[model samples]
Structures are given as C-alpha cells and as structure tokens.
Target: MIEKDIDVLVGERLAYLRNKKGYTMRKVAEALSIDPSYISRIEKGHIPSIKILQSFAELYEVKLSDLLESGDGVSSIKIEVEYEWFEFVETMK
Candidate 1:
C-alpha cells in the first residue's frame, strides 16, 4: 500500500477507536504525548510522520494491521480489488 492509504486507514481507525473508548481528542492527545491538533489532523488524513503513526498505534493498544483491515474482522484482497475497480471507473467516467 502507498503512504496515502496508510494515512487514511490509520487516521480513520484512530478516530474510531478513540470514540469507541469514550475519549475526547484532547484526552487521546494527552495520552499519546502529541498535540490535540496533530491528533485531529491525523484523524483527518493529513499525513504525519511514521513515528507519529507508531505512537498512535501503541497508545491505542492495537496492531498496525488492525487499523488497516476491516473493523468487522473479515480479511481478504477484496479491498484492493474494489480500489482497482474504483480507479478504473473514475478514469473511464
């Protein structure tokens, strides 16, 4: 996967887990030793450094892959297949 894919997936997963744990952005930021605004930007997929992603994953107690795959636990190459189709469709239309 590309850097953008990692950023988007991790950001969305961070936001999801943070909300699931009933924590505010401020609270999560404090726990992660990062700025609240940085956390917000990450959740918005603005693409921060790799060090930041590792930090976030550690704080959330989730594996890096956990954030990448479907939250529903189903694992397959379907996501990639869909993305290829999306790219094809967008290019065609």
Candidate 2:
C-alpha cells in the first residue's frame, strides 16, 4: 500500500499547481472532460493510484519527486495545467 503521506503530499501539490495555473475546478474538469468533483477529490487525497500520480507528473511537466516534495530547498515548480494532463488522468482510471 502507498503511504498516507504520499497521497497527502501529491494532493497538496495538485492544489498548489491548480492555483498556480489559474485553473478553477470547472476549467480543470472541462479540460479533462471529467467531473469537477473528481479533481476536487484527488486534490483532497481521496484518490490513490501511482498511475494517477504519474499522469499528474506528466501533466504538470515536473518530476514525480517534485510533485511529492514541497520545494522548500528544492527549486520551485511553476507549471500550466495542460490539456494532455487530463488525457493522462483518464487513462490511469
């Protein structure tokens, strides 16, 4: 089983990125063609799948470690939530 903290960290990263990219939940859902609630759930750590995590990393154009880490001493990550990210998310589920 994946550790709980990993899910939490990933979720935090999701929110950080979503906000950074100026993507509202609706926009993200529309981009992904998924319900906004799904995005909300993932960002809240209610979903756990390495596949989803991998998709998220590619979506954000960052390494999985970056998404997992808080970028304290690490380089800050700035990314645009892209159209492909949603495609990747769909494949994971």
Candidate 3:
C-alpha cells in the first residue's frame, strides 16, 4: 500500500477502537494528555508517530498490531468479532 492508504487505514482503525470504547476524541486527548485536534487529525489520515500509535493501542487495550492491521474483507470481520467480545467482557466487569 502507498503511504496515504496506510495512513487512512490506521486512522480508520483508531476511530473504530475509540468509538467501540465509547470515547470521544476529547476524552481520548485528555487521557493521552494531547490536544483534541491532534486526535482529529489522526482520524483524518494525518500520520501519527510510533509513540502516539503505541499510546492509542494502550488506551484501547489492544495490541499495536491491531491498530496497524489492514482492513481487507475477512480480517476486518475477525477484528469486529474480536472487538465485540472485548466489549462484552468489559460489560461483564
């Protein structure tokens, strides 16, 4: 994939995780001690640094690979199911 495609893919995954976890961009920014506009930029396909990506993974309680994973058809389904299970487990807590 080209760099732009990768950026959008990663951004989509970040948005998905944030929405799944019921967090607004403002909330995520506060938790990560960053600006809300930074999170908005990330979700709008602005590339993030490895440190920021790692922070997102940590905040979402997912592996870094999950954030970087390409969302091509079948794997996307698997990711959705996995996240659903995670959500269920969270509700049980």
Give the count of colliding residue pairs in each prediction.
Answer: 0, 0, 0
| Pairwise lDDT winner, candidates 1 and 3 | 3
Highest lDDT scorer: 3
Question: What does the lDDT read for residue 70 in candidate 1?
Answer: 60
- Candidate 2 residue 76 Cα shift, in angstroms, is 11
Q: Write the per-residue lDDT of candidate 3 for residues 1-93, one digit (tens) a residue.
A: 224465676788889889989999999999999999999999988977777887998999887767655544313522223666446534533
lDDT of 2 by residue, 26-58 (tens): 887776666888889988876556666666666
What's the alpha carbon RMSD for model 3? 9.2
Candidate 3 regions off by >4 Å? 1-4, 71-93
lDDT of 2 at 37: 88
